[model samples]
Target: MSKVQKPEKSDKIDNIVGMLMEYEKMTVDLMRKATDTPILEQYDLNAPYAKARIIKEDGQIKYRIDEVTLTDEEKKKLKEIGELLIEELDVDIKRLGSNENAAAYIRKLVERIIKNYKIKLTTDSLDRLMYYVIRDFVHFDKIDPLMRDPWIEDISCNGFGIPIYIWHRKHESIPTNVIFQTAEELDKFTLKLAYMTGRAISIAQPVLDATLPDGSRVQMTYEKEVTRRGSTFTIRKFRERPLTCTDLIIYNTLSAEIAAWYWYVIEKQASVLVVGGTASGKTTTINTLAMFIKPNAKIVSIEDTSEIQLPHENWLSSVVRTGFGVSGSISEITLFDLLKNAMRQRPEYIIVGEVRGSEAYTLMQAIATGHGGLATLHADSAEAAIHRLESEPMNIPRPLIPTIDAIGVQTRVQVGEKSVRRMVNVAEVVGLDPTTKDVLTNDVFKWNPKNDTYVFYGRSYVLENIMKRHGYKHEEVMEELNNRRMVLEWMVRNNIRDFKDVVEVIRTYYVNPQQLLERVKREKMEAPSGGSRPA
Candidate 1:
């Protein structure tokens, strides 16, 4: 990859590090406007220095400009002249001090002065010209394939000795050639990120974890204490536009029919758990499912790395801090601690990004409190998911498992040309075996690898049990399922999905079925699209 070379710091103190990048741009523009600043008449890329000539007040001299040194007087003159030149051409005065504040760097400049026997510009003036040449250089221009990368979910560095690795959407994890020039530079960057988050990362606190200004989660271990390298940092990039449920439908990640039934459950305030292997789209699934929640419902989401994004305004997002053992401050609340506090907040719904440790017990206790909760977990199969919940670390008792509304096991299978990933099993916990502890999950839909399709064992038995709990007749339950499935299919067909309409239908249907169904019929009469109105 060709790196787009740029100055590390701009002269515009608004640039970064109290420097001024804009001043450079203004100078170039002035030079360009004054005499149409001529490009070097002779140029060579391979060599750092090539024959380039410029007219100074003294005269002209052939020399490579970038490496030239100037006396104090000439430096002051460069600053004076550059300022006057840039002011002639207007530039955005506001953005001149954005990142590191480049304005502080305007101390001096190089100027052409009278020389022996004649007026001519030498290497000193040429240095000034070269500095003005490329002031618009945005920091990190050269290795931007790694910086501005769209799919890079994570950027990590173990220290100055190793290359950076990025987690891309399609490429998964790939190493980049970007390297810090020194260990001190790497440490400064880590401290900067911690500083941005109002946290500290230093040798006194060898380990540092905090969120960057751009919302990327960062963690760094300093010197040989934590790792063999001097210092290493990892940045988990947050998605700019997270994939919504509609995107899932279009991507074939899940079927519209299943999504429709789930919408009904969500509006009913069903507690759900999403299970998947690493990189199996677990977090995305949690984020997409959050859309089904009632718009006004109060939601509190806790995470070690902030990942879940809800469209609702009534939501609180929190992340855990770790102990400063590795080198930094060890002042972070445990997930268990956050969960206890969340209970007091009385959130209508509680979301844990990924559950581990004692928090599982309190989170389960919250579920028993009648608050709707949504979370994701790492497990291969539905049974495995249950075991992980009931086993040692999580230790969620088997009896309490009934409080969970559904266990969604997302899986991937190879289908000829490419690997196809899907929400293979959406199992409902009707009732567990009293004696044997084994969960009796009715896998509603299973992928048939041979045909490269799914076997939708239509009309979930799970729906029947839940409907009975609500005092609905068998016929009423079946009719409601078909009704929702229709809206879902229509959403898939007409691309009229946003989940808000679907959730409204579910809520209305659950609280009062007759009024909403009747409205759907009456609205269908004058419907312009010829499809059912989920409203």
Candidate 2:
């Protein structure tokens, strides 16, 4: 009835314009809410900023990380906002509990700045801005993505203007597009790394060897003091979940039989040493084998940088500390000191991250004293490991060297256009020859490169000793080994590679072998035929 009188055309137009303006405002508000959420919480924003792919260049396989391009205007805006945020922000990133929390806090701060300045930014632009801000503030900066990449094992920057090199798990070492364009930029980044590790680096203290919060090992040199080319840094990314025996088997690093053998000897309290060249996975092997120790055993691990991750509840991890003041004035704790201290702790097992300097002698002594010792050494073969033990710095006597019950030699080799790690040889330290005073080793497992298969030598002195110690007959020991091999194989087939899950299976076996074995057999029979064996 009231609409009998028609409204003016100008009024109708004004009403339509107001509705359009309100709709636009509502859309903008919704977009702001979505963008303001922590990038870590957003599935789309959480995707890896960069991806790596294998490309053929010059008839050779190459690893390439896709580069992200930003417009000049975007970069200019990013720099301005980054400087302002750094100047105004007062939060200590380390105390933020986790990367997620840090990201959320930084996002809130960024939103505050945006609102205060009334800066107009699209949702996509805001996402990019938040990612970079969180990355620079919470992670390793330019190398953060490299660190986040699970395939990258190592990252090395020689100096400024040099491309960073990354050791891809698949491609081995390859150069990356990321580089520090100037000496000052590299120096600043190196200092930031040192700061992240809670260590100081300067002209006075030019060297920094420390463990990052995420357990990665970082070594840095400051300001051309120790390094000739400005500043340099190397990061050895640590595996958050240590490799399990099942994982090694799946990777073909070793045969299931070798893993079973390790399980048997390690359970019998036999000492072991993993030997390999740099980046050949010595520490990884040690970590995997160390999982075989009894769950309740008292274990003490000493290291310069904490790299070993064990599931044992009774484990004590000790790291060497560099003292303040002068080198001689303030006594610095060394591996030898920690080893001696660990000896006093009455631990059943002593794990040395690596045997170097006088610590090797102490480790051998601990092994000779009947303390189960597990360590890693820089050597390519069992014989070389023995030689290094007998040489200076180690100086482990010939008789004491036999206390090391097993030596696992790991090597990186090229196989059909790919680089892989393999346990080339696993030898048991039988004894020292009385006449020649030479260490006698019995090869238990050898890797055959022809077909990339591992050959069981059919004899293991360590297993024999384990059988004797446990009062098991030859047939019984053989059966036990076979059962363990089957269990490991089943795990590989079933994809039970998580460290905790693997350990649970192992502990279950230790508690009730028959139960676990029966379950494994049932599952193996039910599994698909194609998945019965590891690739």
Best by TM-score: 2
For candidate 2, the lDDT comes to 0.85
Q: After superposition, how far is residue 83 of candidate 1 from its true place, in Å?
A: 19
Q: For residues 268-288, write the lDDT of model 1, one tens digit per residue.
A: 677889898876888888888
Error in Å for residue 37 of model 1:
37
Evaluate residue 290 in candidate 2 and report its C-alpha lDDT on the 0 to 100 scale: 91
CA lDDT of every candidate: 0.66, 0.85
Which candidate's lDDT is highest? 2
- Could you tell me the TM-score of candidate 2? 0.87
- Give the Å shift of residue 208 in candidate 1: 3.5
Q: Tens digits of per-residue lDDT for model 2 on 1-535?
A: 5657688899999999999999999999989875554321111112656555555544444455553556777787778778878877887878889888988888998888888877778888887877777878887787777887887888999999988988877667777778899999998898889888888888888888998889999988888787889899899998888889988998899999889988988887889999999989998889899998989999999999999999999999999988776462377898999999999999999999988898888888888888898899999999998988889987887878888888999999888888899999998889978898778899988999999999999888887777777788999988988999999988887788999999999899999999999999998778767645545
Estimate TM-scores for all models.
Answer: 0.65, 0.87
Clash count of each predicted structure:
48, 0
